[model samples]
Target: MNREIMTFDNVGLAYRRSLNPFSEKNWVLKDISFQLYRGEVLGVIGRNGAGKSTLLRLLAGIIAPNQGSISKERGIRSQLLTLNLGFIHKLSGFDNAIMSLVTQGKTIKEAHELVAGVIDFSGIGHLMDHSVSTYSAGERARLGFAIAMQATPDILLLDEMLGVGDKEFKVKSGKALKERVQSDQTAVLVSHSPTTIRKFCERVLWIEEGAVKALGPADTVLDEYEETAPTRGNSPSKTTTATAA
Candidate 1:
């Protein structure tokens, strides 16, 4: 029987601003509801400050929703949300890979094997022996992605991490992502790149003010989103009209 991999029921998130101790609730997200099934890729898009990253974080169970609920069935794993999420500047890439695997419940020997494959996949070869701080941004992203791939997650959540790499690496990684989706793995990718969304995801969700504005087939929704997005040099009208009471 097919099972739902993840579900969000009216999920909401709010946080107190550090500078505004006396302020009331400040909601970053509200009334989110969705279900994800295995073998499906869901693309999420939103304007800046629309809470795209926060939504992904909720799905990954990294933070609790301020209201409502998020549930996940067994056997779900997630990659780092961004390039710098799990990397420690002081740690070598090799050590980071080993630690990532170990923390995910692999034995030391198993971790070694996994890290070897990940290092090869990253194409970093001997660079793995150097501290992550010494690596370029693209290299660090590749290392993080490699470590996550070693985990063999059932559900993968990516948040614009692909933007860090060069064109060649982007092509390679895009192909890898396609294979993952084709192989019955559930994935949620948050990106501003419409091309990436259309290429990998079968469905798309357009989020605004933390609510889903559109959810449907990828091409249809993405087209709608593109048409509605604000373009440069366009601004809201400014007029002054007042009525005396």
Candidate 2:
């Protein structure tokens, strides 16, 4: 019997304001709990300041929960949550790839080999020698995804990284991601776009006010979220924000 791949038990996160040490802690997330089984793609969605990114950080073990605990069975590969995650702007793309692999605990030789493949896969063969700082946002995203996919983690966590490339690249990357998910790689995608979520995720976790507001099949949850979500026609100002506190 295969055990669950990841579990969040009564997880909660709170931060103390620097100005007022004696003041009550500002709770960012509370009473969060969920289990992600192997080969499942979970979509995390929420309003602005709802702690969607915070939840992903906790799941990645980047930060410890303030109250409960998060557990992972093993073999989880976390990808670049943001542009600054894996590469240094001054470094070459090839160098950044190697550095990312080394950070993930690969040997120097292994990192070198993996970097070669990743650079090739990125279709930025000529640009590999250039400094990463010179690359555009789309190019950087490609490099990050290539490095992450090369590691072949059992679980992949992506945060609004799908639309970073050109249409052709997006098509190619989408196909690649689909193939990976088909091959027993569980995924967690956090995005504000409904179209993107419907394209890849089978399950959706709608978060609001730092808590899970709803959880179930992707279409169902997305429908409910859309209905409840503030729209431009009804609320123009709300559109500017991704999540609400």
Candidate 3:
């Protein structure tokens, strides 16, 4: 059975220009309204700088919409999955793991409890104690993903995670991501590739200029998006065949 987990009603978001506080604010997402059902992997597709990431931030509650309303089920947790992951370069990977948990609203003690699993899943091994700046981008992504996965948020927001990690770790992370969404969990993924959306997402939300262009079955939405989105050529986007561990 399916249940509604989140809803957006007449939502509008805009950011004020730094120089002109009194001037017109730059609108990103406007009049956005949608319903997210439990166990549904929703895919959002848009060109670069189309307010897609901003939408994810809105969904994660990392930022509030400037107008309208976004309501989620009480006590439900959400996290946005970005490759950058936003780690402090000065902090050691081990320390950052705990910090990540704490930032997610977990208590210090709870963060400690999850640190071991995060480290293990990250596969950072002895280098876990090294400063995050010393590690490569892939390593940091591993850390970020590991921490978020351990938190086990009810909703996972993904921003084209296909680029995450090294070649080897990609398989592991991809499988892990697949398993999580395949369960009774809800996820909203932003991607340029329709293949990723088709394989993993239950529904598709096509956005243009920060507003929803189409919202329906993945195939139906993607069909129109591909036809209209000149940037997204007719060529099929390719993905990997990663196996679960």
Candidate 4:
């Protein structure tokens, strides 16, 4: 049996409606419960505004649940990878890579050592010295992804940031991501891409209207989800495949 890495028990999150003292609270997630097993690529599928990103935030400890609890193995590190990571607009891509690594608890020298791999993986070595403000969206996303991968967190919370860059880069990045997923990395992948979910995830959790509608084997849950929204499953985009270990 796989070891349990993290568990969410009836977790809930809410945001204030407004600054008004009498304003009502808006619940974003409610009664979410799940257990994450080590070395599993758990997919999270949801429609827009379904609180998918919010769920990743909850997993990353970026926010706390308003109710219930989340438990994790001691000293586990989780890194949330979004298209827009905290890159300083004025800083160079090289500098941003180091900064991101250092912020992930790596020593300065260690960050420097790992940054070479990040640069190579990103395929943005030529632009390493260029200020992030000058990078195109795809460029920025690639750099962020590279840094996140090199950081090597115990849990990687990915928020729809996969399949970055052009066709060639997509293929390369997908291969690298596949290697990680097939390894002992526990990841929670949130995506609207059915192809991505089907290809990479062993099991899936479907969220609808900010609640878990279903959680089960990838084929079963995705079959049900696609039945509800046929076009979503058929949505066209670049896709890659991997065996879920």
Candidate 5:
């Protein structure tokens, strides 16, 4: 039997429309319920503004649901992979990398030892000593991606972290992600690319208008989603309007 690692029971999240106490709440995700099994790769797919990223943030415990509950297996650790790694602008890329690792629960010495691998993987060795403010957006993203890949989490939450950087680096990161996903790592991957979902996930969750449209075998849900996906200039059904956040 598959071991359940996490369960979402009628999960809902909302934001206040305004600072006023009387302002209405805008729900980004409503009544979402799902089960994540250990050692399985689950895919999340939806059109823009469908709250995909918000769902990952919820799973990573970065935010709490306003209603309902999300229960995780004891001692389970999750990491959400994003290119916008919070780097101290005044700090050197190397120092920022060390800080990131240390905050992720590594000792300072361990973080220092791990910084070399991050530098090698990011291909930003020459700029490692330079302040992050001096690095280009692409350079920062590369370093961020490298640091995220080094983390070992029970659940890896990916928000299209694949195929990043220059063409060569994209290939390298893709290979690295594939190795992680193919292992015993349990992951929740959100992507617009059906090909990616089909390639990596054992199951798929399709969300529309901040609610589940379908959840089942990946191919089944993907086929249904593709059939209904709006073409350019066409608007989808009116649902919650969030920034895919």
Candidate 6:
């Protein structure tokens, strides 16, 4: 039996400069290869503009690779979850949940049945009755997240998308994902939170400048990243790492 849930084979993704076609393509990710195993939470760590989000989109099959291919077992359901976007803004939160779950292959009846659980976890309270457009940014994020939790895909692609509600919700959401991974559901998580990765991930992959920098045990990968990564405070981003050398 193949234990791998997804295999990325020398994958590369690039986008052409719209203004200058003859110019070199802006490569977002390059020569990426990895095997995601069943029931594993593979944490991805990288600095800003490191193509972490691009990698998640590739894994979710939302975009095609410019080179090579990503192979997965036939019929495995995969979905991307991100707090930055989701839900129909004009629709009520309840309507958005129903639409999302139905689009994920659930029947209307089935989706309606799952509404209670979504509401309970979303913690949006009575605000769910209003149009999502009327919600605060954080409220929108919470609603989107609640709808996503109704379906448990075979492969969950998380792009730095931990819950954006109150501190308590963030804690509970993190624990919920850990539970899902423990139950033999696979996931790829991209997060800046080293503590979250340290607590939940079995392994880690670090990407830098569109390429793999490291991939291994969580502690080892995270340790190497922190040691080499440039300071993130008042200093310029690339200044510390390169100038110090």
List runs of model 3 lying over 4 Å from the truth: 105-110, 229-245
Candidate 6 yields a Cα-based lDDT of: 0.78
Query: Compared to the true structure, candidate 4 yields what TM-score?
Result: 0.91
Q: Tell me the tens digit of each residue's lDDT in model 3 across 1-245.
A: 37888999989998887877798898999888888988888999977777789999999888898899999899888888786677888989988888778877899999989988888888986778899989887777788888888887888888877667777777777788889877777889898998878988867887777777677878877777776655544322322121110
TM match of model 1 to true structure: 0.88
Q: Estimate each model's TM-score.
A: 0.88, 0.87, 0.87, 0.91, 0.89, 0.89
Query: For candidate 4, lDDT tens digit of each residue in 1-245?
Result: 49998999999998897898788989899899989999999999977877899999999998999999999999999998887676898999999898889988899999999999998889889999999999998999899889888999989888877766798887887787899987877889988898998988989998776777788889877877777684443332322131222
User: Each candidate's lDDT (Cα)?
Assistant: 0.77, 0.78, 0.80, 0.85, 0.82, 0.78
Clashing residue pairs in candidate 5 are none
RMSD of model 3 against the true structure: 6.0
lDDT by residue (1-245, candidate 2, tens digit) is: 13588888889999988778798898999989888878877888887778888887887778899899888776665554554455788999888888888877788999988877797768898899899989998888888888877877667778777777788878877888899988877888888898899988887887777877777778887877787655522322222222211
Model 6 lowest lDDT segment of ten: 236-245
After TM-score superposition, the amount by which residue 215's alpha carbon in candidate 5 deviates from its true location, in angstroms, is 1.1
Candidate 6 wrong stretches, greater than 4 Å: 19-21, 231-245
Instruction: Give candidate 2's error at residue 104 in angstroms.
Output: 2.5
Q: Model 6, 154-202: lDDT tens per residue?
A: 8888776674667887887877777786678788888998887898786
Model 5 misplaced stretches (Cα beyond 4 Å): 231-245
Question: What's the residue-level lDDT of 131 in candidate 4?
Answer: 99
Candidate 5 residue-wise lDDT, 78-131, digit = tens: 877765556898999988888888867778988888888898899999999999
Better of 5 and 6 by lDDT: 5
